[model samples]
Target: MVSPERHAALQQAWARLLDGYRVTAAAAYPVFDLLASAYSAPDRHYHNLEHLAEMFRVAARLTAITDDPAPVQLAIWFHDAVYDPRAADNEERSAELAATLLGPLGVPRDALDRVGRLIRATAHLTDDRPPPDRDTMILLDADLAILGAAPERYARYAGAIRAEYAWVPEAEYRAGRAAVLKRFLARPRLFWTDLAHQEGDVPARANLTAELAGLRGGEPAA
Candidate 1:
């Protein structure tokens, strides 16, 4: 569970974002509650409120790049709000959930559209979609910032991810998880933004290589 101060900070961030669009406190509390409950579910390990807090910390570094950070911030909030390890459409559904809930709260249409698109981009799928714009790249970078966290923190992240997939057998989980890590390693660049690249790429590659070795050599996961 999060500390009272941490919870209040998260709520305050949400309130500040919505207030720019003229959303009142009364109308905003319910949506915040919904997100809190969703992220706090027992099944979530890596994709929980802690991850949101981590992303928020990363977002703090690069706010100046975007003309309007509201939609980018919105995408960060809802990107994994619907995560289910077994589901293939988590990003799609999360985007829809953002639209459905925020539409009624009066986020502008263009902003809502950009938020939806930003959330979907987090999938990192290799479809033929056009390249992401700058703000979308910022959202994507923040979403993936955990990859380059300190070695100890990355180990905890790996362990938490393993915990989330505990339903699968150990062998199956290792194979699947290894494949995902390898895919990241295979990418031309793990992070898109210059600051993110500088901050995370080398460490992320090292983390992935080490984790892959652990998985392949029968070392304990995380």
Candidate 2:
């Protein structure tokens, strides 16, 4: 959950970023408001304010190492903006929303395009091209950092995710979740950054793998 203090901190962080950029408070507020409204669905579970805060925290740390921050921040805001579990093209929709919202903010056409591309990048577990610059890599890592969280946190996240799909039948939910878990398990690197790779990836994978195994009526592996 995002504490009031944390939410305030995120707003301050955004304010600071805005100060450094050519944009105005007017433009930034609408972007933030629109993103918040988009994620405020009544059925939302894991994709909510808390998730946004966590990504922003990671993005702050990553900003120090990246040349471009605007595109990265835009990506973070819109990556899960349209998180309908049953939708096959949520990423595309989310990216489209980001482009639509940011285009009128006087954002350079190239920067807006990069943000759209970064939003779409989150849909896949693997990317053939080298990560899209430093900022994109950071946004990508932040979005996926949940996979490497502590066991209990990962378990909670998994449960929340499953709850989001409560519309699905039990058997279908189990199968769908198992497939997603297996896909992550097959990945060579779940965390792309050295910091997250060292601290978060193993525990996240272990937690999910164990949970999936137990869900399948076997003993937990972790």
Candidate 3:
């Protein structure tokens, strides 16, 4: 559960973003409640309200790069709002949820579409995924900022993710995780933005490499 202070701060951030888009407080509260419920769902481990809070903290450092930062903020709130480790269409489903929820709250169709695309971009499936626009890149970078976290925090993030997928068999999880790590390592740049690269690339790479080695060495899964 998020602390009262953290929850208040998140509420303020949500209000600020909504006010920027001309959404009224009356409309925003119910929407915030819906989002809070989604992120606080029992099955969520790493992709919870805490992760959203962390992304907001990261987003604050680099808001200037985006053409319009508000939609990116909205995308951050909804990107993993529907996360289910066993589901293949989590991103799409999350995007649709954003559209369904945000459309009537006075968010424009263009903004909704942008948010959907930004959320979908978090899939990290392949190297050939669509090249991100400035705002999309900002949202994507914030979503991945955990990889660049301090060592202890990064380990916690790794463990949380493992917990989320605890249903998978140990060997199968290790193989899948190794493949994901290899894909990140193979990327010419793990983070597209200079700020993100400087802030997270080295530590993220080190974390990935160490975790990959552990997987290969038969270390028990978290």
Candidate 4:
């Protein structure tokens, strides 16, 4: 759970971004409310507000290390807005809603389009070229940062994710989830940002490897 202090900090971060962009507080509040509604689903566990808050915290930390933050923040809001456990097009749907929402916020059309693209890049299965912008990489990295959390936290996240797909049979869920874990393990770098690469990449890989090994009924890798 995100602490009250952290939630306040996230609100402050959002306010600062809005102030910097000259966006009206009126406009910003509604946008956030709409995003909250969009992401609300009783069946979703890790993809719920807790996940959003964590990504926001990670995005704020990462924004300090990067040049632009507008697109990154926007991406965070829309990345999992349309999470559907049984659907494969959640990314695309979320991206579309992002573009529609941001387009009217006086945000530039180009920027809105870029935000849409960034949201789409969060798809778990994709063979497209790498992310097109720094913001996309930051957004992606923040979403995956949980993979590097302490073992207990990682285990909690795994359980939460499994709960989200509880409707699926255990055997099928195991196969699908194992594939996802392998894809991340196969990556040369789990985190795209230099800071996260140095701080989170190794631990994330180790955590995933150990977790996957345990899932496969073997002793966890040390």
| Estimated TM-score for each candidate | 0.96, 0.88, 0.95, 0.86
> Can you write out model 3's per-residue Cα lDDT over 1-222, one digit (the tens) per residue?
689899888888888889888998888988898899888888788899999999988887878886678888998999988888988999999999999988888889999998898888888764445354777667777888988888788888888889899899888999999998888887877776789988788989998888888889998654
Q: TM-score for candidate 1, please give it.
A: 0.96
The lowest-lDDT stretch of 10 consecutive residues in candidate 3 is: 124-133
Model 2 lDDT tens row, 184-218: 78777777767877877778778777878876973
Best by TM-score: 1
Return whichever of 2 and 4 wins on TM-score.
Answer: 2
* lDDT for each candidate structure: 0.89, 0.76, 0.85, 0.78
Query: 2 or 3: which has the higher TM-score?
Result: 3
Q: Write candidate 4's Cα lDDT for 116-167 as tens digits.
A: 8888888844423466667877888898899999989898898888888888
Candidate 3: Cα lDDT at 205: 93
How much lDDT does candidate 1 score? 0.89
What TM-score number comes out for model 4? Answer: 0.86
Once fitted onto the true fold, the runs of candidate 4 whose alpha carbons sit more than 4 angstroms away are 1-12, 124-130, 218-222
Residue pairs with clashing backbones, model 1? none
- Candidate 3: give the clashing pairs: none
Candidate order by TM-score, decreasing, is: 1, 3, 2, 4
